[model samples]
Target: MAAANGRPVAKRRVRLLGGLAVAALIAGLGVFWAVTAPRAVSAERLAAIEAIEADPARGERVFWAGGCASCHAEKEASGDDRKRLSGGLRLTSDFGTFVVPNISPHPDAGIGQWTLDQFSNAMLAGIAPGGSHLYPSFPYASYVRMSDQDIADLFAHIKTLPASDATHPDHELKFPFSWRRLLGGWKFLFFDDAPRTELADGDAQLQRGQYLVEGPGHCGECHTPRNLLGGLKTDQWLAGAPNPEGEGRVPNITPGSPSLKSWSAADIAYYLESGFTPDFDSVGGSMVAVQKNMAELPSADREAIAAYLKTVPAR
Candidate 1:
């Protein structure tokens, strides 16, 4: 009789322990969901962004400054064709191959239907219209620093571009990296919109340069080395990095860099405008496209970029 009673007690203990384990699992899942959920721009901020008037003419400047065509336009597109914005570029990285999507104004294949509010959210918060997180490969991380007016203007300019039905395959990422929801945690750790470098004395030219480089130009995205988690190493800002695409290295543009140490501010600006370095080496490789974009900008903007590069800490 005592053995029979002890068996029942043991069974009840097992049931209690199993229930506790299930409860703990549910709680853990709840925490994971909460942490990985996408966060859009707040309604109040969206309202302010909407209040700004958009100008396509001014946005054209932002377009060049941001180098949208470098990735969004066709790889072989040139001259007027560059305005098509039919994205088919393949960006290969350690994570996987990220095919650039069609950002043209087509209603279905492109973002033609995305409202200004949607665009603002995508640019500033890295959230998609359907409330999914966008992969940082889109460079919205750098765009997060853009001003509301600039974002509005960029949308207007993009709307004016010719629409394309061009489509590309979805990103091919490895397991775990393939999961989009996990990006929420990544953003929480490294999605900083703050200025990467603080200018001394708040000089106006340096400030403009900083805005162009950090906000729209996104030069550091390539120049700065990333951590194991793909976060930018702030300490090495604009110091050359291993080329994510291949074996070579992105040259260091900081003042202390040997390659650029002797380059005068004028030399830098002239190279950007003319695609010829101080030593008369014509721009080559991936920078060929970037130099072309820089040539289209006003001379003053290029000079501002040069002045800013000269001031950066030598890496």
Candidate 2:
């Protein structure tokens, strides 16, 4: 009884059922996420948002502070390594390796069309524009504190960047690790929706510096070692962590550490600028990548970051 193609109606029904089955499978996966995914904001995050006006104009600066572009961007072959913001960089880990996505302003490929709520959910909730969970590599836990206004502005600025349609490489995870649903349990244990604690006596500059380091710079994400479960070891904040990407462990940059005891905030500031320590030795590994972002920051802001680091409870 097929009228359109003159094919058997029974055959058409079978084809339609097959297609619907696949769609059902995908939709079921999405529903599983909707039920199991973590979603809870802590009180501390709220206080930080109250302090700042959420202006896209200012959000641009905060975006830079978070170093959103550095990890997201592809590294160039040149020694100086230009091409900021455009992403194709590969990040390797024991569980997997992920090539950064092209977060550029490409309308079809990038975040150009993402709604503000979508952007906020991505940053704060660790959920992509759809209800799907983003890989933890995005560090949404640290970014959860970003005010809605600031997130909105950051989204706007990202939309303005030149788009690169370079496709992102698939993450190569081992077994259950490759499964996104496996991350739901990991999130339950490690992900904190609480925003950062704002210092009342801390001046605006100090607060800004803190936000940059803890939120966007996500310096702690790498520098601060995590427990077996992947939560930052609260007792050993910023002491040092196993270098997931490199051979050697990430060294402690805290002032209390012997390596940094001789150095002043000014020295750290200079090192961040030149990628060279006071002893004229070059710093390497992921830090080199971070310095690339730091180098672009204003001197005063860099200084502010330096001053803040100097006070970080040593080791």
Question: Using TM-score as the measure, which candidate wins?
Answer: 1
Q: After superposition, how far is residue 232 of candidate 2 from its true place, in Å?
A: 1.6
TM-score of each: 0.93, 0.77
RMSD of each predicted structure: 2.4, 11.1
Q: Report the backbone clash tally of model 2.
A: 2
Scored against the true structure, residue 309 in model 1 reaches a CA lDDT of 96
Q: Give per-residue lDDT, candidate 1, residue 289.
A: 78
Candidate 2 local lDDT, 179-261, one digit each (tens): 77667777777777453333546677777667666776677788788877667775676788888887788878667877888
lDDT of each: 0.90, 0.71
Per-residue error (Å), model 1, residue 217: 0.5
Q: What would the per-residue lDDT of candidate 1 be over residues 249-277, giving only the tens digit for each residue? A: 99999998889899999999999999998
Per-candidate clashes come to: 0, 2
Judged by whole-model lDDT over C-alpha atoms, candidate 2 comes out at 0.71
